[model samples]
Target: MSPIPTGRLFRTGTGSDLVLSRTFRASAEDVWASLTETERTARWFGPWEGDAAPGRTVRVQMAFEEGTPWCDLRIEACDPPRRLALSMIDESGAWHLELLLAEADGSTELRLVQHLTTEDGLGETGSGWEYYLDLLVASREGGPRPDFDDYHPAMKAYFEELPARAETPGHVR
Candidate 1:
């Protein structure tokens, strides 16, 4: 079965944010490692190199992507185990992203927000994130990795329709 797209779009002063979240039965600190630590990240997203500090730039290998491109990401904010904000520019465009973590009742929830300049191509963008985040989950669980084909075209329509649905009355974000 195709993965269901769970991202929601919210307008912001700058532009808009496409938000998605996942929950894990792990501490925030553990989840933080999965996001920041090079070895842990390599299991899912990709490994990053260079000193990581607020206002500093780091090179991250897009290990799963074709050609395994490397991109420079500047860290904007870092509040250990709680919040992290970053920005990067590549051929695709400029991307501002934030990851917020909250833990309660022994489970941690990771919320990812991509600050988008325009809503164009949300289908492709949102699907990409869904695939990556699921990869994180699978890596952590040592389960089978998800196929990108299951997410992209399969989820394209759902994400493409999100903006219009958000405008409807009585819509619950």
Candidate 2:
């Protein structure tokens, strides 16, 4: 058989839909709790600095193999156990992320869609979202944590690794 195919994880400035979405196995309440609760969020997403309230400005510190990126996180919107929206900035540009939780079977489906404004290199900003969102999946499902925070420079490495891998019949490797 021939080798499978895989899409590049961090193809900067790619895709008309600058969105990297993931639907993992979990419950809406479980996922929602982890995201809204700062203490729980710290265990997975980032630092446990403060609360993630709507209209609240929170500071999230993420570091990678290279350095840390300190960003001003603004909670643009919130809906209990359902949806949470955030707006943040980086060296590239402004990023808008809306995480939604939908009921699927006995479990819940968590989807994260991001909108990168014209500023960060290309509209395909926040290379870390895909990785970090996976982290969220693990955290909500009572699984292990993810490696390598702060996807800035690391994203380049991940981007390189993805395209060369094999892909499943209907899934990306």
Candidate 3:
């Protein structure tokens, strides 16, 4: 199967939405709590911290084999289980992840509205989010999870070629 995140890249508005929504057969409580709970977030997303309760700093030291997604981000927003936002210091405000959570069928429909303010190198950002979100889905459902932040050597190849794996041609967004 394809690695993930294989779609045409399009330019968007200043707040153009680059959203990725998925329904997990998991608990809203588990998914929401993990957004800001350091240990939980670390398992599926990176630049981890031991805690995320507001005011305290959460470090996300992300480096992905010079391919997939590469960045070192600092904790920007931590609302825990209900909302969570984080950004790269270098590209602060340029790219952000707004985690919105809602309850459904005794499960959680975690909506990750990842907004990339600009088109410059955002494919990498989206790809990384795509990969990590996969892990989130797996974890939220008690499925197997890949290394969310390790960024092993082969990851770069997957990131570089992700678009090619799409079932449909690139569409304008």
Q: What is the TM-score of each candidate against the true structure?
A: 0.95, 0.64, 0.62
Model 2's TM-score against the true structure:
0.64
lDDT of 2 by residue, 117-162 (tens): 3323431233556556656666767776555444445465444444
Per-model lDDT: 0.91, 0.58, 0.56
Best by TM-score: 1
- Candidate 2 wrong stretches, greater than 4 Å: 1-17, 48-51, 63-66, 119-127, 141-173
Better of 1 and 3 by TM-score: 1
Question: Which window of ten consecutive residues has the lowest lDDT sum in model 2?
Answer: 1-10
Number of the top candidate by lDDT?
A: 1
Q: Which stretches of candidate 3 lie over 4 Å from their true place?
A: 3-13, 63-80, 91-94, 146-173
Query: CA shift at 145, candidate 3, in angstroms?
Result: 4.0
Score residue 130 of candidate 2 by CA lDDT: 53
Query: lDDT of candidate 3?
Result: 0.56
Considering only N, C-alpha and C atoms within 3 Å, which residue pairs clash in candidate 2?
A: 4-167, 5-167, 92-120
lDDT digits (tens) for residues 26-77 of candidate 1: 9999999999999999999899999999999999999999999999999999
